[model samples]
Target: MAVRILHTADWHIGQTINGWDRTFEHAFFFKELKEIVVREAVDAVLISGDVFDNQNPSAEGMRMLFHALADLRRARPHLTTVMTAGNHDPAGRLEAPGILLEEIGVSAVGMILQKDGGLDLSRHLVPLKNAEGVIEAYCLALPFPRASDLPTLTGESAKEAGSPIVRAVADLYQRAVSGAREQIGDAPLVAMGHLHVSGGDESEASERRILIGGEHAVPATVFDESLAYVALGHLHKPQRVGRDTVRYSGSPFPLSVSELNYKHGVDIIELDGDSYSYERHALTRPVPFYRLKGKDGLLVAEVEGALEALELDADLPVEQQPFVHVDLRRQTSALGLRAEVDQILSRYPVRDTGVSIVSAKEEGQAAPSEIVSLKKLEEIKPLDLFYTAFEKEHGEGPEARHLELFHSVLAEID
Candidate 1:
């Protein structure tokens, strides 16, 4: 019998989108995720990492995780699950309930605990049991490796190591894999990790750098052919690294405005004896991310026109409203662009996540565009921004009357 396993990661629970709590979106995704598990008759579920958005997650976030696990256990008592911690999680805290959660068919590995002066390989080994209580496979669960968790090396063997961090990481994996092989018998061993692989694409705005300069990403070679599959996390984009067997199951929902174009989903691995096949199932994003744009640099008139033309469902629930980001071309000024975008978006049933200004076309100065989020709008001076806006709109210098009118408005507001 082929055992089905669901591979997922980067939950980023308790994450907020521009200060808006996304509990509704998460709840919606979980509802669909649970359905997928039950419908697929999944025998095991592997959550690679990023269980929480931050190290000190809110109590509500804690409830969300516990409830999701308890609900899954109730739905499928025979199901097996293994979850690890990411950089965003407090590893030790996640492992606090491990002893109690193990009885409920869930194994949570927060960190690679060192015991008795040697690495504790006991907690890392998890037997993947299929429905009807048959051991079909084994999972070597590894979490986000802290610098402190990595083994130190010295002597001639250490001299050949290209980078200390990379060498330590590779050795840790080899040790864990070697230990898992000792007990898996005829079962094909699978592994899970919450770190960046050499070739995996990253969402710059959402994913945090695992290493200081991101110079020590583990290579795919570290995962040898002995493992049937390797479920990875950290990177938000779903992709195969080195081979199809090594993959990342991206986050279920978009975590940042930069992820607007990303297709978020989960992966399913069908394990049969020693061989397995993989498939990706895209999840339905409950709250859609809609890009609101204008032709070329948004001319003063065109920007307002685009906002009025934007169609949004008036009766839509606030919690289910789509996220909006305005793509404005950089001209000479940002004086009223952000304010206008904010004012117009407020009338529609949508959440304004960000306003991105594209770099202006200037001869010989070839420069990269700066994405100015609304959060940083306060740093800009009002008059300076208005002057830039004035020049961009009219294609000429601002008149003294324009400045006088601007000050008059400011005085009126004051």
Candidate 2:
């Protein structure tokens, strides 16, 4: 049976922690995704995981997601959609098989596995059917690998670098794949899962996992050769791990400035019996949120040059404005650093941007009061100083009540 599919992941809707309005970016992501699905005539769409940044998304977030999915299913009723939960996700809640979603022909293998890593396969394996409703393939749904799942492997905890999480995770994945294959039988099997497959790109969100020791990174080989293609997720960069057979569709949008240079989009995979080929559908290139630091005059010159060069790529629409993070370095004696940045923001069509000023001191110049006269404000709380000077000189009413309460609490401890 010939199979055509679109692979994509990490649509963190309503994610505003990073300063950009993920809501707006998410809408753009789906708009582009729909075009890919329609353009490729996909038989299925696989979302590896992290559909929402948090377990409970905002109302607008949920509405946007449901509307998009409903629209896609409405346009293509026969399209089989599959998704799983990632480490960033609350797996048990997100992975549970939902009847409402299933009714719409969307099969979610979210958080159904127990903490011990055991899965009930009765509902996990979906026999893929053609547009004519004939069985054509099979799907094995695997959620993110958890430490609880591998009781047999002895190892150190994530805090201990020498611990066995790596070995244990690798073994668990081996067992899961083996078991899933046995349950799947002879049909051309496709494994859709939410885990890092060793080679995909890591953004700020994923960086926390890689840095702290508790996470599992699996080798691509854990997936058996019997599988036609392993649709993996968690990483934000579209990548082929060890071999082209195991690939990540990557995040649909840039998750952070760390992923600024990454090519954002989905993957179109064509499965022909024993072989498969894939192509990347480039979504719009996002504006790089930058942090630039230099002397005042040089910083302004560079900012001007950067603005002149900010042209939209062919994949991106012109109206999609870019964001920037600008920093200025100036001698303490040098003046008007704030004014210069304000001037830049006023002149540019920057969607979201911030400029920071760095103070430099010459050998004989007196230090600025903010830096050198720290003794004058040493008795004051940093919050109070900032608020009293800048925040409308807040009157000592309800606003100052909380400040007093905070001071009282600290005073008791002192």
Candidate 3:
């Protein structure tokens, strides 16, 4: 019998689009995910990381997560879920309810710590068992390792340790794999990680760089050929690392405008004896993402025309509507243009809107000119200094409202 698993990562449950809440989209995605789990008859689900958009997630976000997990568990009582902590997650918070969640067949590993100041391999290794109580596979659940999470080397040992942080992380995986081999005989090994792997394509606008001293990404060689599959996270774009077996399932939703072109989905892995095979399952996006840009000569008019031509179904829920990002190329302030665009989009069924203006004249160049003043720090007023910097960047002085806010901040400081 084959053990089936559904792999996903970077749900970003508390994420927002231009200050607009995305609770509905998340709920809809979960509904679709639940159907997939049931339809596929998956034995286990692995969420690599970034379960929330921020470390300090909102109350609504927490509620949605618990409810979603409950629904998944209710659908399949024997189903097991393993979620690790990414850079966006608060490890301690995610792991606080670990004991209770483990009782319900959900293992959440936030931070891996050493027991008695030594590597405790048991904490990071999890064995996957079938409904009949047969151990079929073992998973090395390695969460995003912080600087503190890695084992420390001091005194004599520090001298011999080359790249202590990377070495400790690699050693952790090695130890976990070794332990799994000993405990579960002939069971296919599956490793889950929430860190950047060498050669993985990244979405700069979405992913937070996890590199440390320019030496963060771990090589795929650390995983070795012993592991049947490696589920990775952090990178928002789904891709392979060194081989197809070691891959990132990617984020379930587009976290940024730059990620609009990505085909968001999940991975399905089938474990048969010692061999494993996997396939990508494309997800039904709750909301379509689109980017519309204004041409060189027809700046505002082009943007307006595009917005007017967008076809949307008003009968559907707002979450199902399109998300529009309008890019304008202009010489003057495009701030006022936002209201005009909003007015036009208001007639449509779009859920959210964002406007970005790039100067047509200075398209690929730096700011018009550099501030070459030689004034000392104490010689200038804070407000004037702010105005100088703002003018240099935007090619305009600060507005009345901006000045007011600056004064208010100064007053508060005083």
Local distance difference test values of all predictions, in order: 0.80, 0.62, 0.75
Q: lDDT per residue, candidate 1, 17-79, as tens digits? A: 776779998898888889999988899999999998866667899999988987888788998
lDDT (10s digit) by residue, model 3, range 282-356: 888887788776443236656557766676567987766788776665636645676666666677777544665
Per-residue C-alpha lDDT of model 2 across residues 1-414, encoded as one tens digit per residue: 677877777776666522446566677778777777777777788888778775445577767877888777877778888877665554554545367778777877764454234556665676666666666677777766544445544334444554365665555556656667777666677887776666665675343342113344666766777787888877887788878778887877666544766777788877766667888888885344554443332355576776656652435432355665555544454366545655775566664344444454554466551222111223333433543453345432122234345445555665
Q: Considering only N, C-alpha and C atoms within 3 Å, which residue pairs clash in candidate 1?
A: 333-388, 333-389, 335-385
Going through the candidates in the order shown, the clash numbers are 3, 8, 0
How do the predictions measure up, each by TM-score? 0.86, 0.72, 0.80
Top lDDT hit: 1
- Each prediction's Cα RMSD? 11.0, 10.5, 8.9
A best-first ranking of the candidates according to their lDDT comes to 1, 3, 2
In angstroms, give how far residue 129 of model 3 lies from its true place: 2.1
